[model samples]
Target: MSVSDHAMPIGFLTCPGTHPGSPVRRDDAYEHDLQVDALRPALAALGHELVEIDWRSPVEAFADMPLVLVGTPWDYQDAERAFLDQLDTLEAAGHIVCNSSAVVRWNASKTYLRDLERRGVATIPTDWAQAPDISDILFAMEKFGNDTVVAKRQVGAGAEGQSIHHRAKLDPLWCMEQPAMLQPFLPQIQSDGEYSFLFVEAEFSHALRKRAAPGDYRVQSIYGGMEEPFEPSSADRAAAQAVIDAVPFDAPLYARIDMVRGSDGGLLVMEAELIEPFLYPTQGPRLGVMLATAIDRRLCQ
Candidate 1:
C-alpha cells in the first residue's frame, strides 16, 4: 500500500536460510554468498537501508519497497519455477527490480549461452542431450572431441548437478533426470584459472580469476577454489564486451561474465550470470559501492 512499508532503502533478495559467509565444501561448491556483509555498509552510506528478502518470502513482505535488488537468490536453481513465480509477483505489484525480471527469466537456464553464440558471442562448445533413453550418453564426449567431458544440468549454479566422466555411459542412475550440457574439459582451468569480469550496467567494476583446488575442475569456493583479483587484457575486455552486446535483454543491471580457456587456446564464455551470481564484492568495498551506486540509479528511475 506504500512505496515502502516503512521507507525501506533496498531489498537484497536471496534464498531462505542463505547467510553471509563462505560456502561449505561438499560434492559441489555450496553457496558462498557472503558479499552482503560488504554491501551493507556501502548501501547504508548511500542513505539506503539494506534488507534481506528471502526469495520464498511472500511478495507482500517487500511489496512496498521502492527497489529490490536480486543479489543472492542462489538456491533458486533448486526451485527455479517457484523463483520465477515470485518474480511475477513483484512485477505484478509494480516494484522496480534490478536485473529486470524479464532478463532473469531468460537467464534462468544456461541455454542462453547457445543464444549468445547464435548472435556471434564466443562460447564453449556445448552439446545438449535429453537424458531419456540415453543408454550411451558418453557419445557426447566424442562429439566434443574430448576423452574427458564435463556434464551438468542445464539450469544449475555453483557446481551442483555437475559431473566429470571419462567416456562412461551416462548411467541413468548417476545423472540427474533432465536435459544436460556436455563440453570438453578444459585443462587450462587448473593453470590459467577461470576468469570472471564483473560489471554494473556496462561499466567494468572489477575482475577475479578462480582456480580450483588440487584434483578438482569446478572453480567455486566450496570446491576449494581460490580467488584473486585480475586485470583484463585489452583482448579479454573486448571478448567480455562482445558477450554483453549479445545479451538477450537490452542490458543487465549487474553482470558476471565467466570465461575459460577453450581447447583452441582461446577464451570462451563459460556463462553470463545475470539472475543470481556471486559478485565477490567482498574482495573489495569499492565493488560494493559500485553495486550500490548502480542500484541507487535504478531506484531513482
Candidate 2:
C-alpha cells in the first residue's frame, strides 16, 4: 500500500545490438530502448526503480531483482528454444521473471493459435509447415480457396517474414528450415486496417488503428505505416479479453493484442504480444503510470 512497501527495483531486459551488422533492420529499431526511457521516470515517480539490461546477460545478473521484465528481444523469439532454456534455468535457480516462464513459453509461438481455435475463437486458419513443397502450398490454396494468402515465419515480429502470394506464385520452400504459418489474406486489412489493443494486467488500456502504407500489410512504422488512436467497441474489447484469458497469466504485465476483423466481420487474433510490444505510451500517456501501479501491486504480493 505504501511506496516503501513496494520499492523493489524493476529491470527491463532487451536486445541491445543483438544484431550487429543489421542495425537498420526492422528487429533492431530500438523500440524497447525508447520504452525503457519513457517508463523509467514514470515508475520512479511511484518510488520504484527501473533498470534496463541486455537479454544476453546470465541469469545470475538478474537474481537480485525480484522482477526482470523482458523488453524487445527479437532474436530471442526467433530462436525461442535457447531463450526459453535460459529462462527455465533462471527460474529453477529461484530467479523471477515477470509474467513467468510458463506464460512466456505458451505465448511465444503462433501454435497458440490452435489452442484458441479449439476454444471456439475464430482465427485465420493456420497451417504449420517446414520447408513445404509446392504441393503443400497448392493443398492449402484449395483448402482456403481464397484469392490471396499470407505466408509468415512461425516466430517473428513487425512482419519480418510475411509474404502475400496468389496460387500461381505459391512457393512452399520459401521458409527453408524455419517453420511457417499460412493463412488466407484478409482483404479487410487493406481496407479497414488492423486494430491493436493494449492491455495492462488484463485490463483494456487503449487501442490503435494501424494502416499499411499503400500496398503493405506489415503496418509497422518501419514500413512507412501510420498509427492513430482508437477506442474499441465492446465487441472489440470482448475479443481482446478472449485472447488474454486463453493465456495463463501467473505474473502481472502488459499485453498487446493485434487483430483484424475477418470476412464475417468478427475479430480474429493477429498476434498476442507479451514479451515486448510498442506501448504507444505517447498515445496513452497514463499507460506508464498504470503499468507501474500494476507492477507495484503484483510485487507486493
Task: Assess each prediction's global lDDT (C-alpha) against the native.
Answer: 0.76, 0.75
In terms of lDDT, the best-performing candidate is 1
Put down candidate 1 lDDT per residue, 158-253, tens digits, no spaces. Answer: 678788776554455565588888777888998789999888787777788999999888888877889988888888888888888789776788
Assess the local accuracy of residue 24 in candidate 1 as a C-alpha lDDT between 0 and 100.
36
Report the error of model 2 at residue 123, Å: 0.8
Looking at model 1, which ten-residue stretch has the lowest summed lDDT?
Answer: 24-33
Tens-digit lDDT string for candidate 2 (123-186): 8887788865556566677889876768787766768767777876666565445778888888
Clashes of each: 1, 0
Clashes of 1: 1
Q: TM-score for model 1?
A: 0.86
